[model samples]
Target: MTTKEEIINRLNLQPHPEGGYFHQSYASAETTGDKQLFTSIYFLIESGNISHFHRLTSDELWYYHGGDAITIHMIHPDGRYEVVKLGMNLEQGEVPQFLVPARTIFASTVEDAAWSFVGCMVAPGFTFDDFELFKAEELLPLYPKHEAVIRRYAL
Candidate 1:
C-alpha cells in the first residue's frame, strides 16, 4: 500500500489551506467570460486530518477514486445540513460522485481507512479569491443545529 507521504510526493501536492494535500491537475484553456471553464485537482486527506469548513464561488464536483471512504458535510444556504459518503460501495449506499453547489459551506474527513484519495473539479475554475474559510464561532451561530459538526470540522 502506498503511504500518504508517498502519494503526496508522487502527485506533487501542496498543503491545502483547508487541511489536506492537493495539486491542480487540469485547467481548461477555454474561458467562459473571464474565468476558465473548469479546473481539477488531486486531493488527499489523512486519517487524523479534516478539511476545514469553506465555501467557494464556483460549483465543485467531487469524485471518489480510492482508499478510504470520505464523508462530506455540507450546510446549504437554506440552513439544511447534508452528509454525503463518497466511496465505491454502491450496495452499502456510498456514492462515487457528488456535486456541491456554489456558495455552500462544506468540509470532509476520511473514514474507515488510513487515508483517502479523491478528485475535485470546479466550474469557472477555482481561485483564491473565491475561497472563504469559516471561523467556528462565527459559523456556529448561523447553523445552531449543526454546531457540533461545525465545531468538529472547522479549523
Candidate 2:
C-alpha cells in the first residue's frame, strides 16, 4: 500500500490551507475573460484529517484516484445538507467522480482508512480571491441545525 508521505512526495504536494496536501497539476492557457478556462490539482487527505469548510466561486469536479474512499459534506446556500462518497465501489453507491456546485460550503474526510488520493478540476479556474474558509462562529448561526458538522469541519 502506498503511504501518504510517499504520495505527497511523489506529487510534490504542499499543505493546503483547508487541510490535506495538493499540487496544481494543470492550468489552461486559454482564458474566459480574465479567468483561466480551467485548473486542476492533485489532492490527498489522510484519515483523521479533514478539508475544512470552504466555498469557491466556480464549480469543482472531483475524481477518485486511489487509497480509501472519502465523504464530502456539503451545505448548500438554502440550508440543505448532503454527503457524497467518492471511491471505486459503485455497488455501494460510491462514485468515482462527483461535482460540487459553485458557492456551496463543503468539506471532506477519509474515514476508516489511512488516506485518499483524488484530483479536482475547477471551471473558470480557481483563485485565492474566490476562496473563503469559514469559522465555526461564522457558520453556526446560519446553519444552526447542522451544528455538529459545522463545528467539526469549520476552521
Candidate 3:
C-alpha cells in the first residue's frame, strides 16, 4: 500500500493555500485575452482537512486518480446545492470525473479514507486574481438552509 507521504514526494506536490497539496502539471501557451487556454494540476487532500469554500472565474474539471473518493460540495449561483463524488466505483454512484461550472462556490473533502488524489483542469486557465475564498460568517446568512455544510468547509 502506498502512503500519503510517498505519493506527495513522488508527485512533488506542495502545500496549497486552499487546504491541500498540489503541483501545476500543465498550462497551455495559447492565450485568450491574456489568459492561457487551460491549466491543470495534481491535487491531493488528506482526510480531516477541508478544501474550504472558494469560487473561480473559470470552469474546472476534476479527475480521480487513486485513493479514497472525494466529495465535492457545490453551491451554485442560483443557490442550488449539489454533491459530486469522484472515484472509480460506478456501482457506488461515484464518477471518475466531474465538472464544476464557473463562479460556483464549492469545496472538497476526503471522506472514509486517508487521502484522495485527483487532477483538476481549468478552462481559460486559473489566475490568483479570479479566485475568491469565502468565510463561514459570510455564507451563513446567504445560505441559511445549508448552514451546517457551509460552516463545515468555509474558513
Candidate 4:
C-alpha cells in the first residue's frame, strides 16, 4: 500500500513526464520515470532492447529513458504500419522526450547496449483486467517480419 508520492519519493525519480512511452525508464532505478495505474515497463531487447509493435488504448502515454535509437511500427487498418522511427538523433547529454497517444503500436532499439523506458495509462488507468498484448498473430502480417513486435498495454 505505498502511495504514488511515497513510491516516487522512495525511488527519487523526478516527474520527468515526457508525454511519450519513450520518455524514460521506471524500473531498475536507473532513469527518470512516470506514474502508471496498471501499466508496466519492460526491457525488451538486450543488444537493442526494443519493445515490439502493438496496439494501445486512446489514453496511453510513454517516455524515453536510455538508448541510442528506437523504431516504432504503427499498425494500419490495412494490417501494416508506417514504420515510424524515434530517438535516433539523441546524443550524450542532449536527451529529449515525447508523449504518446493510445492505439499506437511501436518499438525501440538500443543497438550497442541495453536500453529501457517507462509508461502510463490514463483515464481509467492501466490494469491486467484491462491489459492486452499484440503478438502479430491478430495483426495483418505484411511488414518487416523483425519489426512486427508486440508489447503489453492497457486499454
Candidate 5:
C-alpha cells in the first residue's frame, strides 16, 4: 500500500525559474520506477509558474486551502482570458476545486495579503518531460488589465 508519508518523502518537487513557486507532491512513481504517476499536487505561486501553462496535457483541479479568497484566471484557447473567484472565507464544508482544462493557461490571484494555499490534481500525472513553462510578459499587454475586478471574484 502506498502511504501519504511515503509519497511525501518521494515527492518530485521542482522550483519555477520565473517567480512565485510550484512544489509538487506526487502519488505515483515519478520519484523512481517504471510505474506511471497518476496524480500530484502543487503549492504556492508567488510569481506564478509560467511553464505549467501550455505543456500540461491533463486538466488541473485546484482548491484554495487557506487565505482570504482568490480568483482563477484561465487563458482561453482563442488566446483570451476569463477570471473566476474561488471564495471569500471559504467554509471547510464548501467544495474546493476548480478545473482548468488541459492545454489552457491557468493561474490564481490572491484577494488579500495572505498566504494562499492551493491544491492541484492533474489527471494522467505530471512529469518534467510533459511540463513546460512560459512567461506572460509578451502576452500581458494584450490581455485586459482587470486585477481590480478579479479581487471581487475572490471569496
Candidate 6:
C-alpha cells in the first residue's frame, strides 16, 4: 500500500490556504469566453488537522479517492449547519461525492482514520482572489449557535 508521504511527494502537494495539503491536478484549457470551465486538485488532511472555515466564489465538488473518511461541515448562508461524510462505505452512510455551493462556509476533517485523500473540483476554475478565509472572532457572533464548531474549525 502507498503511504501518505509518498502520495504527497508524488503530487507535490503544498500547504493549502485552508489548512490541508493540495496541488492542482487539472485545469481545463477550454473556457466559457474568459473563465476556465473547471479545475481539480488532490487534497489531503491528516488526522488531528482540520480544514479551516473558508468559502469560494465558485461551487466545489468533492470526490473521495482513498485513505479514510472525512466529515465535511457546512454552514449555509441561511445559518443551516450540515454534515456530509465522504467515504466508500455505502452501508455506512458515506457519500462518494458531494457538492458545496458557492459562498457557503465549510471545513472538514478525517474521522477515525490516519488520513484522507480526496479530490476537489471547482467550476469556473479557481483563483486566489476567489477564496475567502474566515476569522473565528468575526464569525462567532454572527453564528453564535454554531460557536463550538466554528471555534474548533475556524482558522
lDDT of each: 0.92, 0.94, 0.93, 0.40, 0.53, 0.92
Tens-place lDDT digits, model 5, residues 72-117: 6677667666766554444643346677788765555553344355
Better of 1 and 5 by TM-score: 1
Q: Candidate 1 residues 109-132, lDDT tens each?
A: 986546889999999999899999
Report how far off residue 154 is in candidate 5 (Å): 20
Clashing residue pairs in candidate 1 are: none
Q: Which TM-score value belongs to model 6?
A: 0.96
In candidate 2, how many Å is residue 141 off?
A: 0.7
Which wins on lDDT, candidate 3 or candidate 5?
3
Positional deviation of residue 70's Cα in model 1 after best superposition, in angstroms: 0.6
Which runs in model 1 stand beyond 4 Å of their true positions?
none
lDDT for 97 (candidate 4): 44
Residue pairs with backbone overlap in model 3: none
Q: What RMSD, rounded to one decimal, does every model reach? A: 1.2, 0.9, 1.0, 10.5, 7.7, 1.1
Work out the TM-score per prediction: 0.96, 0.97, 0.96, 0.46, 0.60, 0.96
Worst 10 residues of 6 by lDDT: 107-116
Residue-pair clashes per prediction, in order, are: 0, 0, 0, 23, 7, 0
Per-residue CA lDDT of model 4 for 19-70, tens digit only, reads 1222223323222224243333422233322444444554554444434344
Model 4 TM-score, 2 decimals:
0.46
Q: Which 10-residue window in model 3 sums to the lowest lDDT?
A: 109-118
Report the lDDT tens digits of candidate 3 across residue range 96-138.
9999999999999987657999999999999889999999999
lDDT of 5 at 142: 47
